[model samples]
Target: MAAKKKIRSPELEEGHLCYICGKEIHGDHVYIKTRRRSELHIHFECMPGKQQVN
Candidate 1:
């Protein structure tokens, strides 16, 4: 069976770090699951173009 993919909601609290740049996400960030199924929090700008919020 294939693994289920999902886009997790952003953390509303302050002090969450970006997965790519490691900088603090200011507001309205997003979290994506990698191939390994690990969750990573990242800023919208830091996310790759191939990844889109539905």
Candidate 2:
């Protein structure tokens, strides 16, 4: 079986920008690591088709 890559959600900072909205993250947010090993941040509400996870 192939191993899954770990996903990390770093704490919001003063200058962090959302990947989708391109605005500073002031509240709840999420993040993703690209294939090139770079991190992208996004606001929670900006995620399309978002669903609540149990």
Say which candidate scores most in TM-score: 2
Which candidate gets the maximum lDDT versus the true structure? 2
Task: Find the 10 residues in a row with the least total lDDT in model 1.
Answer: 6-15
Model 2 spans with C-alpha error above 4 angstroms: 1-13, 51-54
Model 1 over residues 1-54: C-alpha lDDT tens digits? 999998665554556889899998776989788999988898888878857669
Q: Write out the backbone clash pairs for model 2.
A: none
User: In model 2, how large is the Cα lDDT of residue 48?
Assistant: 85
Q: What are the TM-scores, per candidate, against the unseen true structure?
A: 0.51, 0.57
lDDT of 2: 0.81
Off by over 4 Å in 1: 1-13, 33-37, 50-54
Q: How far is candidate 1 from the true structure (C-alpha RMSD, Å)?
A: 11.3
Q: Each candidate: what lDDT? A: 0.80, 0.81
Query: What number of clashing residue pairs does each candidate have, in the order they appear?
Result: 0, 0
